[model samples]
Target: MSSNDSDSWGAVASSYVQVERLTTPPCQTLVNRVSLLLPLNVPNTIAFDNGCGTGVLSAVLRQQYPRLPLLATDASHGMVNILRRRIEHRKWDEVRTRVVDSRNLEGIQDGSFTHVFSTFMVCLAPEPDKIVGEMQRVMKPGGVLGLAVWGDPQFGPFSTPWEKACRRLVPDYEAPMVMDAKWTFAASVEAGLVEAGFKDVVVWEEDVPWRWDDVEAVSKYYLEGNNPGNVGMIDAFKARGGDVEEVRPIFEGIIKEDCGQKDGSIELHAPATLATARK
Candidate 1:
């Protein structure tokens, strides 16, 4: 990812963390499953949480393995600040936060981590292979690496509407390209891990549901919030001579109508893929 992309995420660290906490079941699932898969009680175990936005997975991992050393890193300095604050508030002395790109984990020695994990990070990379290579490089032989990513956005509840809205508004717009085709499916993810020299790879897909009590809340997250994806959509809309203020209502209306509103709330099922492998 570019510095600008990291900066965009940094700008919305607070809101992004809030919304992700409520909406990202796949992330929680990755943490739970990886905890079960890895030998947390192993002596001298150290873990890396790459792209550790706001330290959500790091916090959970700390609770799971109180004595385990945790290093959380992100490209966004703003995200690292939130993570540092979280660590300070919780007094997790074993947990450390750093601002670093997942693609090039500078100053981190090879095979230094016994367990490496990332959630919703690899897919966002401009080059998923570089991130995977770094993850594999840092992981000790026989160590496990786990990651979660969005499945096909066409089948996703929240992403599909926005995708459709953008296409409708912008005549020449195309959905953002996937960093790796394998990132969108469980089997492909497994194959990619194997290709990266990981063994005993396991992958699965799930539909995680997110609920919002108000349409405006959804609008605020996608529009008002400093979400990089939405910001790009707004840019595309303007590039096509569409006014953001005018297009937002139309976009919200499409989302409300298509995303299945019930009892004054919107329920969205986000299709996600989770994968783990031993290096």
Candidate 2:
């Protein structure tokens, strides 16, 4: 990950505390899909949530399955600390949070978990293959692994323009090399689970449209969420004689024009896939 990406999360850590209200609903949608793929009855099962951002997803899981034993870990120490505090407040005795890089699970024992789950963190890594291998290594035989990846939402207003703008600006921008790095599973199958010897691989996609009532909200995500890895792209735009300050306004207008509705919310769509496989 680039400094911009790192800085964005560092900057937003305080604000993202109330994620349920500020962030959109696609998170829950992905979680629901994971829940569906889990075994019918998994009592007393040990689960691991890798790349567990602010711990919001893990916290939500605890709320849904109070008895589910979970170990939540993130690559970001800041995120782990916040999540630890959050889980502590939740009183989830079985929940343990830590900071661990996805590519290496050094301290985790083999076959320590019955199920492993992750969301939206694969593409940023230098090697998702290793991460998936580590995840599989930590799971008990017949244990399930659930992960969600962002699928290309070509039809989405925000995604369409941003992806287009990135190419128009930065010619050398490296998209993920993994087949599904852009959110399909070709790379994941080739570089991930299959390579790691996981069986019964299953993949499904869902499109969730985010409605932002405030233009500032859309601007924030653009300038914040996607901006870090996009500095090169942004600089390219600036070098082309585009007024950098005008970028935000232009994006806001685009959202207002395409996805915005009479209901005072701008619609942004995120298409993603929920993939599962058992070992």
Candidate 3:
């Protein structure tokens, strides 16, 4: 991650609670899958959380294995800042926090950890292969490496209705390619891990019914989340001469119509792939 990337990530750290709330279940699922593949060796196993935004993955790690020690790191200083506070408040003494880019984990020596997990963040790295290499370098010879990335359908993180609004409002609006396309493929993920010297790699698909009880709240987040993506979206709408304020209602109306569930919650398909291997 570059300095600019750090700045952009930090800017969104506060609002990321929303993202975290929406993602925690999948975080739990990924950690649970890792635990099944590589049972922890108490007092011996040390884990690394690469690109641990707001410590969402770290929290799941702690919940699933309360005694496990962790070192959570991210390239964004802002993310590290918020995570530090969370650690202090949550009283997670076994977990340590650091600000380090996943692609270049300097000062972290080779074969330092028993297990390393990268949840959803590897895809955001500018050089994902380099990040995987760094992860492999720091992990013990038989250490487990678990990873998660969005799969299949495009824009799992964004509502499809939003895409519709963009295309209708801005004739040439193309969704930003935030995640590397190649990384989204299960084969690409397994191949990358194998090339990084990991063995027994396995990749599998998972999906969750992502739900929101309130349409207004979801629309509010889209309007005010201030994440780099949301900011860029509003900018695109304005740049294309659309009524900027109309975007929120468009998101709400379309989502309610398309994804609203029977229990009065909006549901969307959130597909992701998880991979596990030995280093």
Top candidate when judged by TM-score against the true structure: 3
Which runs of model 2 end up more than 4 angstroms from their true locations? 1-8, 17-43, 153-159, 163-191, 224-227, 230-236, 239-241
Score candidate 2 by lDDT.
0.65
The per-residue C-alpha lDDT of model 2 at residue 21 equals 43
Q: What is the lDDT of every predicted structure here?
A: 0.78, 0.65, 0.80
Ranking the candidates on lDDT from highest down gives 3, 1, 2
TM-score for each of the candidates: 0.90, 0.81, 0.92
Cα lDDT tens digits, model 3, 69-130, are 89999998989999999888988888998898888899999999988998888776688889
**Candidate 1 lDDT over residue span 155-256, tens digit each:** 345456766676666656555543356677777888888888899888898878778877788888877886775666566567768676766777788878
Q: Give the TM-score of candidate 3.
A: 0.92
Candidate 2 per-residue C-alpha lDDT over 1-279 given as tens digits, one digit per residue, 9 for 90 to 100: 344444455555665643334223545655565567664237757789888878766866776777888899877766777787777776779888776777888799999988788776665455667778889899888888777666642223344554444444455433322223533443544346676888888777777666676777777755665333344445545665655565566666666776778877776766666677888
Candidate that beats the other on TM-score, 1 or 3, i.e. the better one: 3
Top lDDT prediction, candidate number: 3
Candidate 3 yields a Cα-based lDDT of 0.80
* Cα deviation of 57, candidate 1, in Å: 0.7
